[model samples]
Target: MKTLYVQVDINSYNGKLYDFKTDIADLQKGDVVVVDTINGMLIGKVVGYTDDTKATKWVIDKVDTTAHKARLERDKQLAALRKKLEARRKAVDELTAFRHLASMDSEAAALLTQYEALIQ
Candidate 1:
């Protein structure tokens, strides 16, 4: 019998490739599977099959549809939060630049400083 070695790529890990042994014959590309790594159990996508015979880890199980949906939602939320923060940072920089244009002792400069501190 030929041992199946599946190449897995974890989303968070990006381009890294991890190989694990499995008996599940129905697994296909893009299928999410739980892998047994030295650190612990991790979820990864099956990118392809590997021909290497030496294997020390096993693919525990495929991730269910419910879990996959939850992960996708979590990723979406994280991306939205990152975009919001980026916009806020750009606004803050513009505000700071606008404030710096005023004279050092002017009342407008003082007010702007107070407003900037409040926003920050």
Candidate 2:
């Protein structure tokens, strides 16, 4: 895998470095590349390279309007899935805390069990 340093021009942030790795050879600095991000398909300019972080990189040469739109849609779907997962995780944590509290005190245990039944 070849490492490439990219500069992304975003509205809220300026000149943030997004390091990407690619199997496609001959990528040079200042080359406009399409990168898949959690936000969307970001148009990034290759600045340089780095020896930091190792992961599978998904890098594309160019992104047209159609591809960009598809990327955005996919990202939206992923965000929704992540939100649902986080909610489930929060519920599990709350239940675990309640169970721990119930184990500590007998008086509160009855009240906590009732509350848990209502939520479920």
Candidate 3:
């Protein structure tokens, strides 16, 4: 019977360190591995090796990290978009105040002064 072995030390989110032995000959140090957890399968980085901790479960797989990369990229784009939207909102409000001021509305200047103060 073949049993699972984990040899690499992993960085887990919960700050737990584990030692496992694997039959995967090419499973080297510094690889990203998928391991089974109580919550779900999580990705961990193989930072080093150790003989200290015991492993009772298997490293499910070694993933390519395409999904992770894509998620990071999407988040970056989303942040940029949100920042642009906020800037545009401010600009639109300022333009509306200018229009009111052009019509000689009395409170428009006060509104613009308040906006400038808030921004500073």
Among these predictions, the greatest lDDT belongs to: 1
lDDT of 1 by residue, 11-79 (tens): 778779888999888889999899998889999999989997687899999877887699999999999
TM-score for model 3? 0.53
lDDT digits (tens) for residues 1-120 of candidate 2: 645433433333477676666655666666667876777766776665566555345566643357777999999999999999999999999888988988999977998979978987
Poorly placed runs, candidate 2 (over 4 Å):
1-63
Error of 1 at 86 (Å): 30
Q: By how many angstroms RMSD does model 2 differ from the true structure?
A: 14.8
User: Every model's Cα RMSD, please?
Assistant: 9.5, 14.8, 6.3
Full-model lDDT for every candidate: 0.86, 0.68, 0.69
Better of 2 and 3 by TM-score: 3
TM-score of each: 0.52, 0.45, 0.53
Error (Å) of candidate 2 at residue 45 is 23
Q: How would you encode candidate 3's per-residue C-alpha lDDT over 1-97 as one tens digit per residue?
A: 3444565444555656665545455566678887776657677766555554467666777767788999999999999999999999999887786
